[model samples]
Structures are given as structure tokens and as C-alpha cells.
Target: MVIVKDERMSRKRTYLMCPPERFTVAYAINPWMDTSAPVDVELALKQWQLLRETLARLGHTVHVLPAQDGLPDMVYAANGAFTVDGTAFGARFRYPQRTAEAAAHRAFYEEQGTWAYVEPTEINEGEGDFAYLPDAYGGMILAGYGFRTEAVAHSHAQEALGRPAISLQLVDPRFYHLDVALAALDDGNIAYYPGAFSAGSQRILAQLFPDALLADEADALAFGLNLVSDGRNVVLNAEATGLAAKLTAAGYTPVLVELSELKKGGGSVKCCVAELRP
Candidate 1:
């Protein structure tokens, strides 16, 4: 099968991440989370560190978000805020357990004083629902809603980012966030799992990215779509063999990272990473 990819350039990006110092599965929120399951905090931290060091080795700048106690899921920093063109749109989680994580994002943005942080009035899970495609249609936001983020928050994000937002409805609870089912490979292309989206949303995606790489259910269940790409290189879970093959066929170098430990908290590479587009 031929994969039609539209690309011209790729650039190194600056990323924001939190140390998995206090990371654990102390509660059950998402389907992946099982409070009864044993969490190897040491392994989790090691995995997170590997992810960070891997990004750094790829010539990307990684900024650290100090982990706070009592907030184990804070390590999933992508849910904190969606920063685009230097402006930060903060998140308000649906579950109360993750609510305090938003304030931590607010503090990071405010304290850094680099980004024009906008505290949200609506309940939006930041990058969890918002995926920006810079080269697609001159840049747009693919926003998701159903389980975690509010649909109304799409307009707020559109207004904040100065980009048109295409609302996609996620039907599967496991793929609660857009980042879980769909990942923007770069600015022009994407790879997604259709089963995670509504039939209508799936149609929309197919029409939007006719040449997109598609992931099978096995790959999606492996957290394949929870990836971070720097145009040329894509970092994802090592378990996503199908996705890795698909990505490689699409002309992207798949960089597999061991992030299974963090999966206990219901996130992977993209979850621990927040791109700072300044």
C-alpha cells in the first residue's frame, strides 16, 4: 500500500514535562486505571526519565514541570494545557481526582510568565482533547468531546488559538481523549484509530486526511496513538507494533519508548509531553 505524505520541513520543538516522582495508580478514573493493580513507582519514574532523555537526544528541549505530592496523574502533563503560538489554554478535568492538576498547569504557565495563559471557564482537558495540525489547511484544531472534554470548549479553544476547530466525537471510553485515538504525525498528516471515534467523526477524519495512516484495534489498545512526533521522528509506546509499521510506511521514523509503566495512570508518550509552541 502506498502512503501519500505531504511534507516540506521538520523542526525541533520545546516540550514541557513533569517528573513521575509522585506517579502511581492510586485511583481509578479512566478505563485503563485499576486502583487494585500494583504500581511500580520506581519503574514508572524510570520509564518517564527514559522518555525525557529520549526526547532530549532527539534534539528537543525538555522543560521540567515540578511534580507535586497528592497528584499522581500530574505526570500526564499534556492534560494540563494546550500551548500554541505561545498562548496557553489551561484544562479543567472532568474527574475531581484530576482537577487539582489544572491549578498546577496554571501555576507553571503563570510562574514561567512566558506564555499568555488563559484560565478556562469551561471544562476542557487541554491537549487531551485538542490536537493542532499546523500544515493542514493552514493550521486547525481537531477537538474531541464525549467522555472527558466539553464540546463547548472547542469554541473557546478556537478563539484562543486563532484556529478553526473541527469537533470530533469520541465514542469509546478507553479512547477518552483525542490524543488517545488520533495523533497528528506532523503538521500535514495523522494516524488514528477509527473504532475509537463516532461513525460521523470517522467519516470526517477520512475526508480530512484521505492519505492518513490507520491503526488497527490491537495498536490502539497498545496506546499507539498516544504519540509525540517532531515531524520526522515519532515517539510512541514500544508495544504498538502495528502502528510502528504503519508509521514507518508513512515515511516517519518510529522511535519506540518504554512507557508501559506509566500506562497504569492511563497515558503514554503524548500524555507526559506538552509541546510549547512559542
Candidate 2:
């Protein structure tokens, strides 16, 4: 049974995105990546542009982070940092290939001159593992570990962002990051696939968000939970029909966008966009 909530209010958001000019699958990190598979560079760029334009058309501000050469996965700006209330908690990627993207993220925030950027010591994948709920929920952060991020860094994030972070352990290799299996639908709600997490972590999620939407395995595999919500309008992968219907039932306007090309590198709508809560 799909859980439906009522009257979700909409809010405008600021997002960060990058062009997929340098995007390609040269190495395999996640299960989705295969060096043997072919990528259509033009298609990837087209999809990224549509995502950016759609967000802007929805009355949200979109910031472009220039794509650097040799960093194909740099288009996944959500992995760069977790920003809230003008403080940017920078990321330190686990793989050697993604490590340099961290410095570029830090530099972007530094150049902005308004944000207080924290230089990371722990190997955390920014918003990829850290999902922030605003101060309305006492500024709670749902942090995922056991894959891209470490449990110790939860404290580091808590200390740095001054927010309470609940640690969720990911067990499924495909849903390696919290964002892939769980989404912060709004400040007070979320949608997730239970199988992506450990048994204990599933219990934690249940206790915290009893009314949270649960995605079926099929939709979850479509990267449905890897979505960005501005409380009312949800931008997600086009193939996530089940999740999209559930969102509609719960009063959300699901704006479908195709990112199959980007998915070649293991990302979709949310992967290409980073939410900045001011």
C-alpha cells in the first residue's frame, strides 16, 4: 500500500549543476558503470541541459559549476558538498578518480565568498551521503554510511553543520549512497526503499518517519528515490512510474526528466543537481 500525505507546501530552491561535456564511463566504480558500455556524449549533454532548464522554469535558481576536463563524473554536483544556511560541508571522495572533484567543489564555494566552507578531513561524499532537513525539523541530517561515507564522519558533519545527523547503514551495493535509496521529500518527510539499508537502519527509519513513502523494488532500481523535491514538485527519473504515481497520490507534482545517459555513470536527476538551502 502506498502512503499518501496531504497538502505538501511548495518552496523555491537553489540548485547547483554542471554540464556533461567531460562525462564518460572510463572506469567502473558502482554497479551501474561499465567501461565496456558505450556512452553518447551528445545525449548526456542534452539531458543535463533539460534538467537545468526544467528547474529554472519551475522558479528555482540554478547555479552552474563548470565541468573540468578529466573529471567525467564531475557532473554529479550533489556529491561535491552539502550546503545549508550558508555553510558548505565539503566532500572528500572515496575513489582516487573522484578525489580531485572535492577541491573543485571547495574552490567553487570559496569563490562565492558568502559561504563558510569547511575543509573536510573525513572521506564523506557530501550530499550523496548527507541529506539535510532544515531547522524546522531541528535541522536533522539523515547521513548514510557503510559505503561512500564512514560512520565517524557523521560526528564530523554534526560538528561542522551544527545539525543532528542520524546514521543509516547502507547494505545494498547498488544503492551505495543514501540519496540513491532515500530522498528528503520535504523538511518533515522522506521516501525510501528499506532493502537498501541494514535491518537496524530500517528500524531507525521507521521510527523516525512513520508516514514516509516507501518505494517498491522496481521503482527503486529506476533511481526513483534519487530525486529532488521542493516540497511540492518532485523532479525524478522518467522511468520511475510507480514512485511518480505515489508522489501524485500524495499531492506532489512529479516532473519527469530523462537522464539515462547520465545514469551510465550512475546518476539521474538528483545526481545532476545539488540543492542549496539558504
Candidate 3:
């Protein structure tokens, strides 16, 4: 059943205790898999399984969905599910290649009967490019409109979620998703690679979060800012030294993990796992 909780009363925090009933994932089969990239299907399978076990170990219920053909590189499922107000809205994608992806994921969410789908003429890809930050002053959502998402999409999402979301346009092509350059820490802190964000957007972020830690290019490329929060804690890529130090200084322990292989697919912690916290 779907529950609509007031964002104001939820006191939503970055860190979360893993929810037991929600631990499954869906990944796209890498169509670019070739000898050069050497898409080891076995390795990919193993990685997905390991990720499932990791989340399971942390007290989550896990499920894994197979990647469909023709939608290679469609492994980013978080973009398909927009969770807010206890209702998950499956989104329609802007890219034609992702149309099937959005449809399939939307069907799945509807099957659960706990989510509502937001259908829009403009492309509205999900969380890969957007993040919902629930803080004390109310839930502030930061949206990144880059290569994968557009401003129109963000507006549609805001209307569907019934919440205010700050729209940030990402000008850089390399950093196609906001998660690629920024992360929300459990300690009410933000870790970001400023270069990936536009100067104006960076300034706004600074104003909103004056104590945010700046991550460098090396770390940014290494998925340094793509972190995962377990309600009260976070796990970051091991290479984010500066970020780790800052997070530790802020009174939250950082769990470091080696995700070098996933880096090949242009994803890190955030991309590897999707957290289901209420």
C-alpha cells in the first residue's frame, strides 16, 4: 500500500537504516560490451550479486532484474523510480533509447501498487540526475538537468512529487548526471566536485551549504561524490580522501569501498546501489 507522509513531519535525514523488504535491483546489459571494454558478463553478474548481498547484509530485502536487449547501458534504474511522499513515480525518459526502459520500470512499479507514474511529453528521467535531500528546514531537492535530464523534466517531477526542487543546469557534457559530481552526506553536509557544476550553480550550492567539501577532479572521476547513505552513515569510494576527512570531521564515519571495476561503466557507489529508506 502507498502511504503519503508529510515531508515536513518526516524529518527525513541523509543517513538511513536499511529497510528489510526492499533490496532488489535492475541493471541493463552493456551493449558496448566488447573485447576492448571486455564486458565480462560473468563479472557483471557477480558484481550485481555482490551488491545484492552487500545490501542484504545491511538488513535489506534484495531483488535483481535482468537487463533487456536493445536497451543496453540502461542499468541506471534509479532514474526510473521517483520516490516521494511514500509514493514512487515511474518516469518517462527523454531519450528514445530509454523509452522501453521507462515503460518496463513503470509497469514494475505499478505492479507493486505503491507507486504512481508521471507521464509527460518532455523527458523526465529519474534520480540518476536528481536527488532529494530531506533536511531540518524541510525537504530540499536538488535537481541536475544535464545530458540525461532537462529543466522541463524537473518541473514535471516537482509537480508530481508535490515538493519544491531546486533546478540546477549542468553545462558539462562529461558530468551528465548530478550524482557524478555531488553527493549528500549523512551529517547534513554535501560533497561536490565543483568543476562538473556550472559556476552559478556552484555558488548557489555554496550559499545553501557553506560547509560543503570540495572534491577534486581526480576524485570526481573516481566517483568520489557518488556516495550512499544508510540513514545515519555513508559509504564512499576509497579515493575520496578529502571528502572522507571532511565527513569524518563532521561527526559521521565514512565507510570506504573499492569500486574500481564499476568505474569502467561510469558508476560508483551511488550507481551501484539504490537505497530504499522510508
Each prediction's RMSD over C-alphas, in Å, is 1.8, 1.8, 7.4
Each prediction's Cα lDDT score? 0.90, 0.91, 0.61
Off by over 4 Å in 2: 1-6
What would the per-residue lDDT of candidate 1 be over residues 1-278, giving only the tens digit for each residue?
A: 55445442457999999998888888888899988888888988889999999999999999999999999898999999998898999998998888999988898888887889988889999889999988899998999999989999999989988999999999999998999999988887889999999999999999999988889999999999999998888999999988899887777888999987898888999999999888
lDDT of 1 at 231: 87
Mind giving the per-residue lDDT tens digits that candidate 2 earns over 95-144? 99999999998988889889999888889998899998773367799999
lDDT of 3 by residue, 1-278 (tens): 22122211212232112111222222322221232453444555555455555555555555444566666545555656567766565556665655787776666656767655556556666667767766623776788986777787777777777777888877766677788777776434567888887888988888988867677887776667887765435667777777777666655567677655555556667765544333
Better of 1 and 3 by lDDT: 1
What C-alpha lDDT does candidate 2 achieve relative to the native structure?
Answer: 0.91
lDDT score, residue 15, model 2? 92
Count clashes in each candidate, considering only residues at least 3 apart in sequence or on different chains: 0, 0, 13
Error of 3 at 32 (Å): 11
Q: Report residue 199 deviation for candidate 1 (angstroms).
A: 1.1
Q: Ten-residue segment with the worst summed lDDT in candidate 3?
A: 14-23
Single out the weakest 10-residue window by summed lDDT for candidate 2.
1-10
Tell me the deviation in Å of residue 152 in model 2. 0.7
Q: Is 1 or 2 the stronger prediction by TM-score?
A: 2
